[model samples]
Target: MADVEDVQVVVAHQERATVRVGEVFLKIDADQRRTDVEVEAMARAPIPTPQVLWRKPPVLALAGLPGSALGRLGEPPTSSPKAWSAAGAAVRTLHDAAPPPWPGRTLDEVASSLERECTWLLANDVLPADLVTRNRRIAEAALRPWTPVFMHGDLQVAHVFVDGDRVTGVVDWSEAGPGDGLYDLASLTLGHREHLGDVIAGYGAEVEVDVIRAWWSWRSLIAVRWLVEHGFDPAAPGCEVDVLRSQV
Candidate 1:
């Protein structure tokens, strides 16, 4: 093993912290259960994921995957549209695989959470009342029941790595479980609407664009509070707030 000298903070908050040391990543989380789920999900997933190097209570180590992330939130994707489509194809592969043994949030649970988040946003005056209300209504379209599939529950663009037009790997498996496939699609395309058609084309399935749009609203509305609480700026250009405002 190479000596770890260079360390970079990937993310840090009350719940967890992730740092990179050379080619290895060390994730520290107080809850072992989440780490357990992440390890198990990586083992079960059909798509590429970071290899687990080792684990210790409160810390899990993983070898780095090849290539860079697909893109970041609140920024234009540097990857070609073809790369985005490749990522879409990769997601489809994961969805087609056998479902994970664990369950994920049901549509009712999602709706309930959305409602609560909306209430909080309004109470906190996070945005204009009309803006929140309009987006909430749009979110309703995503509340309908869906047949569960193997989902990378947090398929944010930053979690997906690409090499040329091919998807090299996807990181962050703590949120993987049985969930709606569209949720993953929506998450991947959240702030990158221009790539939706390319992604869908590579998905190799008929998907309702309207439903995906609904999920965009649902996801953004629910995520803003969490991002704020966690010290991320969702108001940045091309981020969650902008995504919601773009709906108008």
Candidate 2:
């Protein structure tokens, strides 16, 4: 039903797609799952982000990537620690940019998103029952009361891009919101824990590293659960369900 073409979905999730439109890029949500589009549209001008192309029914296009996600690149940085440090600095800049309340979101909203994933898995008869209890516990621990700040809810390495060891752009804004910034830090830092300490420290929030690690581990577990539910191969990279189960 949509007329846009030359379509290339650079990154995709359960409900949205990132497509190119001429010189710019657009994120088109076929299912109106997140209500923050209009708000983001108004507020993005002040933030250091890609130029938004347009937003109408069934299509919200924005600037296409100036580069690819850093994590997905085949080569590791000459100094991995420095690369992550730069990423933390970048996230801080994006979060500090002024914006209004992103409608239909709160800390509770984040908790609910995790719950819904579990529910979907269970309904599909794919969730391992024992793992379900463990996930619930992790989610409970993560749903703490905290000040709301802009968070890249899905800030994984693959969602980032780099050029000459310098971060060029970050893809995917579907999960952007106000929450714990440390959680976003953890999402990108956990897998590279050895180097992460310096990275988080460079971000100027040494106190939050432990909390960020907890969230980083929690999200890894959730990703495993989602993969199992969707019938994807868990042996693939980033699957942490087996490790999570061992901890139980």
Candidate 3:
């Protein structure tokens, strides 16, 4: 093992933080349940994930994946379409497996949170009234019934790693559990609309394009306030705000 001489903060907030030391990542969380879920889900997932180095209460250490992340929110993906498709295929495999024993938020919970976030966004004047309203209407399409499948929960393009056209692994398992499959897909393609067709082509199944678009609106609408509070910029070019605007 390498010595921890140089440390880099991967991500940090009040709730949790992750730092990298050599090839190891130490994730410190405010909540243990999320860590528990992450461990179990990684152990159970059929696809590749970071190797668990060790766990000690608030900290869980994992080995880094071999390649770079699939893409970034505001940047064009340099990876080939085949790599994106491979990511979709890996997600399909994860979805097909049995779900984790713990449950995810129900539809009502999701709807309630969506309503609150939407209200906050409007009240704070975070975006134009028309932009919020149009996207809110589009979001309604995602509120309908959905069959539960094992979901990565936060399938950000940055979370999926790849080498050439091969998907090495996915990281960030704290949000993993049973949920709508399209939510993962929508999350991956949220700010990268041009890659949707490639991902769907890799998905290799019949999925409603409208439903994906709906989730896109719903995801972007609910994420603005949180991103701002967490020191992130959702309004940046090719980010969540742009995703919402594209819906119009």
Expressed as tens digits, the lDDT of each residue in 65-164 for candidate 1 is: 8889999998778999999999989999999999989878887799899999999999999999999999999999998988999999999999999988
> Can you write out model 2's per-residue Cα lDDT over 44-70, one digit (the tens) per residue?
623345555566867766665555555
Query: What's the lDDT of the predicted structure labeled candidate 2?
Result: 0.61
Q: Model 3, 88-149: lDDT tens per residue?
A: 89988998999888888789988897899889988989899899989998888889888899
Q: List the residue pairs that clash in candidate 3.
A: none
How does candidate 2 fare on TM-score? 0.71
RMSD of each: 1.7, 5.1, 1.6
**Candidates' C-alpha lDDT:** 0.92, 0.61, 0.91
Off by over 4 Å in 3: 1-4
TM per candidate: 0.97, 0.71, 0.97
Q: What's each prediction's clash count?
A: 0, 9, 0
